[model samples]
Structure formats: C-alpha cells, structure tokens
Target: MRVMTKSALRLLAVPLAVLGLLFGTAAPASAHAALVGSDPAQGSVVKTAPAQVRLTFSEGVLLSRDAIRVLGPDGERAETGDANDAGRGNTTAAVALRPGLGNGTYTVAWKAVSADSHPVAGAFTFSIGAPSKTSVALPTQEVGGGAVGTLYDIARYAAYLGFALLIGAAFFIGVCWPDGARTRPMRRLVATGWATMVAATILLLMLRAPYANGGTLGDAFDLGGVRDVLDTRPGAALLSRLLLLAAGAVFIAVLFGSWAKREDPVERQDLAWGLAIGGTVVSVGLAATWAMAEHASVGIQASVAMPVDIVHLLAMAVWLGGLTALLAALWGGHRVERATVRRFSRIAFGAVVTLVVTGVYQSWRQLGSWDALVSTGYGQLLLVKVGLVILLVELAWLSRRWTARLGETAVRGRAAAVAQPVAAGRKGAGGGGGDASERAGQLARQEAALAKERARKERDGDAERTGLRKSVLAEVAVAVVVLAVTTLLTGTQPGRAAEEGAAQQASAPVSEVPEPLDVRIPFDTGGTDGKGEAEVTMDPGGIAENELHLLVTAPDGRAFDVPEVQISFTLKSKKIGPIPVTLGKVDTGHWSAANVQIPVPGEWTIAVTVRTSDIDQVTRTKVVKIGS
Candidate 1:
C-alpha cells in the first residue's frame, strides 16, 4: 500500500505536472491573432470605401513592410495610393487610400506584425455606395464552402477531440482498472492519445512563426515567429500541456511494473485507479484552461472568469465523454446481461443530466447575447449543439424506459406484483386434491414460463437499448462536430462585424489628403544674438538630458545674462497651443525635467520664448523629431 501510494504520488505526478506545464505554458497557434474588431463593419453600406485601411492591434505593432492588396468588384486593384505609417501611436495604423473609384465590391487584405512579433492576416469586404451586384460575397460560404474558416475549424476540433480523448483514457486506465486485464490495451491507448495530441500540438506551434514573422510557411517556424505565441499566456499554456503529456507517459510505466509489482491485485488496482484519476484530473483541468487562455482574460479579470468557466467546461467534458464511452462499450457488447445493462443505463442518465445543466450554464456565461445565438458563428454552432443534445435526451429516455422493464425480470427470488396474483390464483386452484408431484410439475411449468418471459423481455430490451445507445453515440459524434466548430469559432472573431463594414464604406472620409499648407509666424529676437544649443536623447526607459552652452557676444563685447529662458513647441495643426516649460539654470544654460512629453509624432515648431528687462522675444524654429 505504502509502495503504491509512493509510486502514485511520485510517478503519477507525470500527467499532472505535464498538464501544469502544457496548460499553463502551451503556446497559441502560430500566425494568428484573434480578430478583436474590424474597421469596415459587417453588413454596412457606405458611400465610399476608405483609401487607407487601418487595423487596430490588441498590443502595440511594429511597422512591417507588408503587402496590402485592396481588390474592387471587377477584381481590379482599387487602392492607387501608397500605404505608410499614418502616425505613431500604440496599436493603431493608417493606410493612404485612393479616391475617385467607382462603386463595387471591395476586399481589403492585410498582413501585419504586433510589437510582440505575432503576425496577423485577414480579409474584409465592403461595398462603395450601392453595389452593382447587390448580393455581396461573404468571406464565408462561397462556392468553395468557407475555405479558410472551415479548415481552421476542422483543425481546432481535431485538437480538442484528441486532447479530450487522451485525457479521458488516461483517467480510466490510471484510476478504474489499475490491475485489470486490459493493461496492455490501456497502455497502448495512452500512447496513442499522447502521440495524437503532440503531433497536433506541433502543427499549432508551427503556426506562431508565420503569424508573427509573416512571409511563407517556413517563416512562421522561424525562432522569432514561434517566440510570438510562446511568449504569450495562450502559447505558454499550450506548451505546458504538451510537456505534461510526455511526463504522463513515463509515469504510466512506473505505476504498474516497478512501483506496483509487489502489491496485491486489489491494492494495485487502487493505485492504478488513483493514478488514472490523477491524470484525468490534470487533463480535464488543462482542457478547460485551453479555452480560458483565449477568452480575453487579462490580469485580475482572468482570476474570476477563467476558473469558473474551466470548472464548468471540465464537468461538461466528463459527463459527455463518459456517456459516449459507455454507449460504445455497451453497444458493441450487444447481448449484455439485463442487470449490468441496468447499472450502466442509470449511469448514462445521470451523465446526460449533468451535461445538459452544466452546458447551459457555461453557454450563458460565455455568450453574452440572445441575438448572438443566431448572429455570431459561435451562436449558430451552439444552436447546433443544443439541437443535438435534445436528440440525445430523447434517446436516453428510451434507453431508461427499456432498462427499467428489464430490471423487473432480473429481480431475484419471486415474481413481481404484475405476475404474482396470477401465479397465486393458479396455485389456489390446484390446492386440495392435487398430489405433491402434480403440484411440483405445475410449479415447474409456471417457473419455465417465468424464465421464458424473462428471456424474451431481456432480448427485446437489449436490442432496444443497443439501438438507443448507438443513437446516443451518433448524437455524441454530432456534438464532436459542433465542438470542433465551436473551438474554431472561439478563435475567429466576435462582435463588431457590422461596425467594421460601416467604417469600410465611409472610406477615408472621401476627402483627398490636403496638399501641404505652409504658414509663417515671426519671432521677436529683440536684437539679441541667439543663445544656447541643447541636446536630449529619448529611449523607452528613460531620458538623458544634455547641457546647453551658449556665449552671447554683444555688439560692444559686453556680456549680459538673459533671465527666465523658456522653450515651447507647437503642433502642425496648432489646434492645440504650444507646450511651454521653464529651462533651469545649469553650468552652461537653463533646463527642466518637470514638464516633458511628446504627444504625437510629426513636424512641430519649437519656440524659444525668452524674458529679459531689455527684451521679451519668442524665437520660432524649424520642425524637429522628438524621439526618432
């Protein structure tokens, strides 16, 4: 017992630890940043599509030399102007758009890199005025049937299924059948699960590079590209899950032969079961974590939302997976004894109940809108799942009713109430003059009828139960499809589809970029020679201020001090006034760090506004870059 416990604790840590690693550390798929919102809202009609396309990032983005192609309805390139950084600000970019284009279906395809190096690529379509072709082609469901989106959904669903099955199988093997006959098969199952999961994982990991670095598939696999997903919580959690899987494999071996060999069958069973349970626990936890990491949980907000949904999702997986497995086991082993069938049927019922209740609660929490059920991809997929579950509920009811009747026949010792009265009446009729032998023969006939009836009912019940169970499996299979779709939907986008379309239609305000306008303002130097030369260097962390030395030579070579020197800068628009601050007295000149900030990037005029008894003059200077 002690040995098994030690083994279970020491070695069983494999799956848990791996789970911890993978879930806490697994990286997000390569080359994809979840779409937060779009510029041209979905289903919006605009008089003009903007010349420049802008996409906002969840984090600050690097200025990448990406090819952005905007195609018009006739499949001609619509954007005649060049794309450049409109200005410098966090998580925002602007494209120079072309004007005077005719009305048509316009598609804007963009590729960009976030400051963290994760690359993102996607396309959105908006129409100019009323489209020549009123029926627009949505990105989804063309003749090709949702090419990219569907493919993504398929891959995600595959990962979700493999992860769930692997975890579930580990749970049963480690916990329920520790010393059972299927040890070899169980080991094989665990091996298959791990391999399936890791291979899928490697594929996902490979995506990060392309999403971050951009270019071809090879680019995504590069170090910088992979680093993008790995550095984030989503990517880290994924990696951790993979590591846990490898460790679990090793721990599975220790649980049986070396660590558990000396123990009795029952003791070994307990040990194995505990280990399986432990593995399952980890897998389930991580599975929930997988979705949690993706769902916008940042900082303290994550603490509440992730844990609640994780528990709810894990509970749903268990109930659904367990029932699916039970159905497969019972359906295949067709002529199951009535009693065993009854026991399993009861279990399936409870599982279904839990699945439905928890599923509803989780859905309500994740999906915030009623309209979303039909509007969003997530909503539609959820509708499909709900429909499938109702079918499952129906099949479960049929199985329950059949199994209950079968249980009646399996009751021991005596006939049931329905048959008891009839049997008693027959015995009473044969009572007074009948010999013991005659009575015994009559009883034998009665017993045979009861036995035959039990046999008939059971056969019928088994067939009925088997059919119902298979239907349940079908429902499960449908659910898997739904789940896969769901996983994909979680990654695609949510909210603001319409808003994006509208913005696209508005199209850069339909105003031409104005020709540069020059304006002049005079500086009152007050006949004094200019004073100081100052330099300051700015970095992300801190600023290094330099001293300015200026020697003023008056016409008569008489040195004079200019008190209260102040410098202020005005933006190009000058809609905002000059930002003025004092320059303190230094060894050479005056300086101050008290007021400092470069609000926006562009050309700005510096004004050296000086104060002296002889003169109050503002010296206007040319534009300068603050932290170029």
Candidate 2:
C-alpha cells in the first residue's frame, strides 16, 4: 500500500511541476488571426490611388498568391501583381494596384490562414474619388464553409479521439492491468485506436489545403495543393504527427507481444520500467505536434504554453481513454482484480486535478474578462463544456462507488466459501458413514450443494460488475461530446481578441474621417418621369459639419427635376432626433446643402423624400455609419 501511494505521487509530480513553471511565464495569445489595421483603411476615401493595398493582422498569417484580390468599380481585377508579405513581416500582406487607376470605389477581398492553421477572411470597399454607381459584389462564402470545411472538422475531431484512445488504453493496460494485454478485447481496442489515429491524420493532411483555401472537396486529392500545404507550418506539424505515430506502432507491438508473454517477475518489472519511459517520450512527442502548430505556438509566452498544453492533452487522454479500457474489462467477462480498478481510480483522480488547474489558466488566457464569458461565442461554448465536465465528474464518482462495493462483496464471498468447506468436513467426520455406499452418496450430495452456492455468488458478482460497466459507458458517451466542443472551441475566435478589436474601434482617432456616405436609392412615384434614382452623398462623413449633395437621374441617364426633395438623419442607438437637411437647387437635377450638421457617431438611418408630382411622392431609407 505504501509503495502504491509513492508510485502514484511520483506519477503526478511531473505535471504539477510543469503547471508551476507555466504559471510564472504564462501570457495571453489570440487563438485566431484578426484584421487589426488596413491601408486606405476599410470604408475610407483616398484623394490619390495608393501604389498597393496593405493588410495587418493581430498575429502572423500564412498567405498564398491569391490571398488578396482587389476589384475595380467594374468588377474587374485591378491588382497589378500577386499578393506578398510586403517585406514588413508575416503579420502583414499587400498587393500592388495597377497604376493610374480610374476614380471609383474598389473592393478588397482577402483570405489567409492564421498562425494557428485555421482560415480567416473578410471584404471591404475604399473609393478613390467618389463612391461608385455600382460596387463589386462580395463572395457569399469567405472562410471555412461548405463540404470541405465539414470534412476537415470531422477529421480534426477524429484525430483528437484517436489520440485519447491510443494513449489512454495503452496506459491503462501497462499501469493498471498488465494482464489486460492478453485479453482479445483489450488488445483489439488498442489496435483500433492506432488505426483510427493513422487514418484521421492522413485525411487531415489531405484536407488541409482545401480547408484553408476554400476549395472544393476534389481539391483534397490535388498533389499540387498538398505540396503547397507542406510548405506551411500546419502542414509540417501534420507530417511530424505521422512520424511520431510510426514510433507509437512499434510501442504497441512490444506492449501486446513479448511483454504479455513474459513469465519472470524480475524481468517483467525491468521491461515495464523501460516501456513506461519509452511510452512517455512517444506520447509527449505526439502531443507536441499539435501544441507547436496551433494556438500555443503564437502570441505571448508561447514556449511555456506549448509544454503546458502538452500536459493538458496527455491528461485528457489518460482520463477519458482509460475509462474506455476499463469498460471493456468489466464487460469482457474476464476476472478483473479489485486492485486494478483501484489503481485506475487513483490515476483518474490525478488527471481530473490536472484538467481543472490547466483549464482555469487557459480560460483566463483566452477570455481576459468576465463579460466576454457571456458575450462571446467562444466563451459561451466554454461554459457549456464546463457544465458537461461537472456532469462527467459526477458519473465518475458513481463508478468509484460501484468499484468499492464490488471489492467488499468479493471479500464476503471468499469468507463464506472458507466457512462452508470446514462445515462439510465436520459433518462427514461425525457421520462416519455406516457403510461405504452411504458415505459415497453423502459426499456426492455435499459436492452438489457446494456447486449451487458458488453459482449464486457468481450471479451476485456479475450484477455488481454490470453496474460499474453502465457508469463507465455513460462517462465515455459524455466524453465524446466534450471532445467535439473542444474541437469547435479551437476554431472559434477567442474572446480576448474580440474584446481588443472592439476597444480599438471605439478609441479610433476622430480626426481621420472615413469615406463619404454615398448611396443610390431607386424610387417610382407612379408618374411619367418619376421612375429614376436618387444619388445622395455626405462628404467627410463624421461627427462634424459636412456638405450634402443630391442628384436625381432619369432611367436614360439624364438629369430630372423634382418639385421638392427632403432628407433627414436619425441615430437609432442613441435615440436621437431625425434632423432635417435644407437643400437648394444648384442646377437642373442637382441640389446642394452646405454645413449640414450630423451630431453623433453611430449607425444612422438616412430617409429621403422626393416629390415628382404633388400626390405621387415616394420615400426611401438607408443605413450608414457616421464615424467619430
């Protein structure tokens, strides 16, 4: 008992030490790349056309030649050359525009893989002179969506599941129940885990290109795409995982092969120690492949987060995966010793402690604030996971209770068996059989009764085992959901990044006015010349005095006159008034208003009323952002 306790303590010391080291150096990292700033900024107007458009991200991003696309007002490609890093850093991407571009609004569409390997995309328009009559349409699908995304997500989830199974089941057999390796069911479970890991990793490697590039499912088979992916950090991580898995295969072979066949106690002990050391190295290596390429590798204190994340992954596999192996043992009808179950229970408790400590730290690093926990999607999902984990811990407790009850029942059954044998011996001696035939008959009856008693005890034991099996099965089921949520959490934007972006926008300098608010509203007043469009423009569209212009154009591109035209602005967020603008006719179809005051910076509704005939007037409303 003393030795067992010491061994368990030794096993826990490694992760605990790692956790302590992490606490000293831990810092927050954005899980996904976000656009922090852009040149000719989003929705800004530049007097002259810039040589190139530059985009800046919160973190480093992996870019392809087609990562940035700039379209002219006519929806034609306006970029002169391919997108490049602009010699600034990996965190910036730029594309040169054609020289002497005509005056109109140009749309910029961008897509890039985050340093963490997930894809991100967005679109915005910037005008050279005035807002164009028509702007280029944006693509409906930006980043990860459609069939390719779904398959890639599935592969990611499967890889995590496979890692848990392979590492957990092997650990259970080696440390908890060595004899489990000889059982067909246990051996098959471990082998299945290995196969799953291999297949899922391969699928992920193939799907990485299409998943990041927004390509079709068929692109997964493109060798050229695969080669391109290999050139990136994420691709290299996947390849490293495969190599570690190869080493893992050899470990599995030795685990169920020669190790299971060993009969000498001394030799087996030595081999067990060697296997433990080797297995630890291989498992840590496998976990590092994910840690070094994903969220842990980017942002602040990455060197510490990487090792800490590795421990977290290993702990998760040990708890969830060991539960699976334990279930197989209970249902396999093999005689599982009480000591084996107890050993696993201790290990599971340690794993739970590690999970909680690391989970809290990770939550802090990703969220950075309490309000974000309720406001952000990533934070909300994390709450759901925490609730599920609480439920899982309850189920684990039930399994432990059943294990203890089974142990007590075994002890009572053994005591009853010993007492029964002595009673039979005393009865036979006292009878001293009057004849050889009578004595033989009496002996046969006693043996038959003993057999029946043994069968009754066996039935009771089976009932207890059934209870333990049910609880463990429940744990495994809940674990699957937890893993799925974890995979989704990785793909989501962290709350810290979202909050930072909001603060950045709120604190932007007021002096840097955005582009003018330009919108074209079509209307028909049921009159002969009323079926035209209204072109409205608000220059220097910010919280300051501005000039407003309104032009009424006929369907045939000719100026059309209206008897009366009225325009009003309303700030919905602040519940401000609908301030009216007074316009005077400058020319045939053009009206101008000088020093029109917009008192606030927010999303405002602009309502325009035009009267073609006295009773045939029409009104149209459009929303526009008034920058501070």
Candidate 3:
C-alpha cells in the first residue's frame, strides 16, 4: 500500500508541475465573438442618414452575402448591397443603405459565423430624425434555439461519444490487451463507435446550414443551403472529420483482421509497433479536426492552445473509452490477465494527469476572472464537470485497489499450485509402498486435497475480479455524464466573452441626441398673484445626465417670483422611483440644475410644484418621452 501511494504521488507530481508552469505563463483569451459596437449604435436617433451601416465584433467573423439585413420602417428592404468586411478586416461587417431613406426607425438584423466556427446573430434598431413605431417584425426565439438546433446539438454529442469510443477502445486493445481484439464484445464496441461517428458526422454536415440560418428541419435538405454551408470553415472541419474516419475504417480493418491473426511472436511485435504508430497518427488527425475549428483556434495563444486541446481530447478518449472496453473484458467472463489490468491502470493514470493539466489551463483561459466561475453559465457548467471528474477519480482509485487485490490473489493461487506438486513428489519418494492397494488409496486422498485447494483459490480470484468489475462500471457511468456536460460546454458562451461584451455595451457612447424636451405647465393657487406658467426645458434629453432649467412667469409674460419649486420624475412602465431633481435659484423666477440624471428610456411623468405663498401652492404634471 505504501509503494502504491508513492507510485501514485510520483505519477501526479509531473502533471502538477506542468500545470503550475502553464498557469504562470498563461493569458486570457476571448471565446465566442460578440457584437461590441456599431456605427449608428443601438437605439440611437440620428439627424442625418448614414451612407452605410457598419458592425464591429469583439473577434473576427465570417459574413455571408445576406449577413446584414437593413429593413425600413415599412418592413421593406433598405440595404442596397451585400454585406462585406468593408476592408476593415474580418472583425467588421457593413452594408450600404438605399439613398434617401425616409424619417423613421430602421431595423438591422445580422447573422455571421464567428472565427471559432459558431454562428452568432442579433437585431437592433437605429432611427432617423426621431423614434417611431416600426413595422419590422423580428423572430421571437433566439438564434439557434428551435428544432433544427436541438437535432444538431444531439449529433454533436453523439460525435464526441463515438470518437471517444473508437480512439479509446483501439488504444486499449493495442497497448493494454492485444488479445482483446479477438473478443466479440470488444469488436462490437469498436465497430459501433466507428459507425456512430460516421452517421453523426453526416447528420451534422447536412444540418449545418439550417442550424446556422435558424431555419426549419426541412431546410436541411436544400441543396443550395448545403453548398453554402460547405464553403464555410465549420463545414470544412466536418468534411475533414469524415475523411479521417474513412482512414480510421481501414485502421480498424487491419486491427481486428490481419493484426489479430498473426501467430509468430517476432512478426506480431513488429506489426504491433507499426499499428501503434499508425493508430496514433490517425488519432491525432481526428482530434485536430476539432481543435483547429472549435474554441481553441480563435482565441489568444491559439497556436499553443490548439496542441494542448488536441492532447486533452486524446487523453479523455483514452481514459473514458478505455474504461468501457476494460469493463467489457471483466464482465464478459474472459480470462483477463493480471498484467493487462496493471498496464491499463498505468495508462489511465497518465491520461488523468493530462486531463487535469489541460482542463485547468482551458478553464482559466476561458474564464479570465475568478468571479466568472460562479457568475457565468460557462463557469457553473465547468464546476459541475469538475465535480464529476473528481467522482470518477475516486472510483478509479477503488478499481486500482481491487486490481491490486486480484494480483495478490493470482500470486497466492500460483504459490499453492507449485507447493502441491512439490509436496506430492516429496511424499512419494520419502515412503516405500508396502502394497499396490495402499499406494492407490494414498494417491486418491492427495488428488481430492489438490482439487479442493484449486477450487478455493479460484473462488478467491473470482471475488477480487468481481470487485474490480463493479468499480470500473461505476467509472463508466460517471464518464458518460462528464461527456454530456462537455458537449454542452462547447455550445455555451464563455464567461470572458460574456463579461467583455457587457462592458462594451455599458461603455458605448450615445452618438447623437435628435431633440431636447420642453414642457409648459399652467397652475393656479386660487389667489390674485398665484396664477402663472412654468416653462421647463431638459437639454440633450436622453438616457443620461442633462441640464434642467425652469422659469416661472405670470399670465402677462413677465417674470414672477415664487417661494419654492420642486420637480420629480417617474417611469410607470418599469415602476421606477419618483427621482427628485435638486434645483437652486439662478435668478428671479428662474431655477436651474446641472447633471440631472435620467436612468432609463421610457415615457416618464414629470411633476412640478409651485408655491406663491405659505398657504398657496399648486402641482402640475406632464408625460414626456426620454430617448436612449
């Protein structure tokens, strides 16, 4: 037990050291492109019509011809040309607007593929002159949230599962137990994995267009849409995966066919080495198809992250997939050797170390800050995955313990067999037989004793094997949940991107204010000098700080002095507070305040109170629209 603990510590020491090194040098990288800013700005009212609409994203994007759609107030197409990068690189998309656009709100809906090969889309309105009711109708559901998306996500999950099984099972047979390739269960597992991969890849490829465009499932059958998807980066990656699977089919054939059939030890060793090298190459290639197109490829230090991601994926496949294969061997009533189990334990240990190191680096890169771990969806999901991994590791340790017990049982069984033969020989030589009948009786008693001992040893070995099999089965079950969570993680928006996009939106400046708000309120306190009008003006009246000026005048248009004046605002739509405005007397009958803050955009009720005397005061209210 002490030696096992020491060995486990030694195996962990290297990965921990490597993890420390990675953390020291690693930097945060943005994942999932976000719409950072735009030319007109969201919900802004401009006096002059801009020649073209431009959009800027946090990262590079791949634009289709109709990526940017500009709709006029009448729900008519307002854009004159196809969307393009406008020579500002792939991070910006723009489209020219039709000349002489009328004075009303225009809706801009955009859809583009991120540099990481995921689709992103949104819609916002920028009005000309003043805000107006628009005729444009937007989709109620978010992009990629309907039936087609569900099917595509399922296919993605299946592809990951299949890859894990094919690569992991193949590696297990080649390195842990070569004889396993000859077993019906192992062969079925590997073949099923390969077939699943092929089917899932094809489904994803066909559904790519509809998934990106947010179309119906029937759109997946459109030839033109499929061709369009084929021209994109994600489609290319899917195609590459299919091609690699074709090569993998050949590898599988060689593995269970000619390689399994070889009898000579020398030839088999040479062939095994060849298959190992070939299998590794194919596995790396298959993994690259994901690493080069997914979240790792578009972020900072992508060159470094890509290789690490590939290693991470391969390690995951070897551990989880190999566990399934090992379970099959133990439960299928096969005669599993001690050496085979020990070899797999070592391999699984190495795979776990790699997973830990790479997973840490990835989590850091995508999260950027510690707060994001619990605050963001991506981080929360990662936490769940980590918990599952810890459980899996505990189960793995239990399996290792059982493996050690099984080894001890095998050793004891061997010792008993050797001792029984030696004891029989000694007894036969030590005593001379007086008669043939006496000798036969003694031999019969010895035979019965040997049979009973053999049966006891077999029972002990079976008990240990049963314990190991149950532990491995538990690991397999936990591993399935881990994979499911991983698939969801791939689809989620990373925490870093979410935070950055929010910061960008908050910091974005409102470009122009079309008009200021001015209102006149008439009041009477039922006194000779109490009848007057209050002229209130809020300069640059938008969803921001503004200067407010108030002037009290008599019915004859001359300045009138009042004892006190108070003003307040309220937004009934959101049930916001009646925020009071502090005012000081600027001159006779005039009050002014700088930095009057309006919190949000909505129809606000502005109330004014005027006091001509201690006992005479009146309040008046007016509804005003505040722009964002």
Candidate with top TM-score is: 3
* Off by more than 4 A, model 3: 1-28, 137-142, 408-461, 509-628
lDDT of 1 by residue, 172-209 (tens): 33333333223454455556656766776666666544
TM-score of every candidate? 0.49, 0.73, 0.74
Residue 111: error of model 2 in Å? 0.8
Ranking by TM-score: 3, 2, 1
Estimate every model's Cα lDDT from 0 to 1: 0.50, 0.81, 0.84
The Cα RMSD of model 2 versus the native structure comes to 10.1
Candidate 1 — what's its lDDT?
A: 0.50
Better of 1 and 2 by TM-score: 2
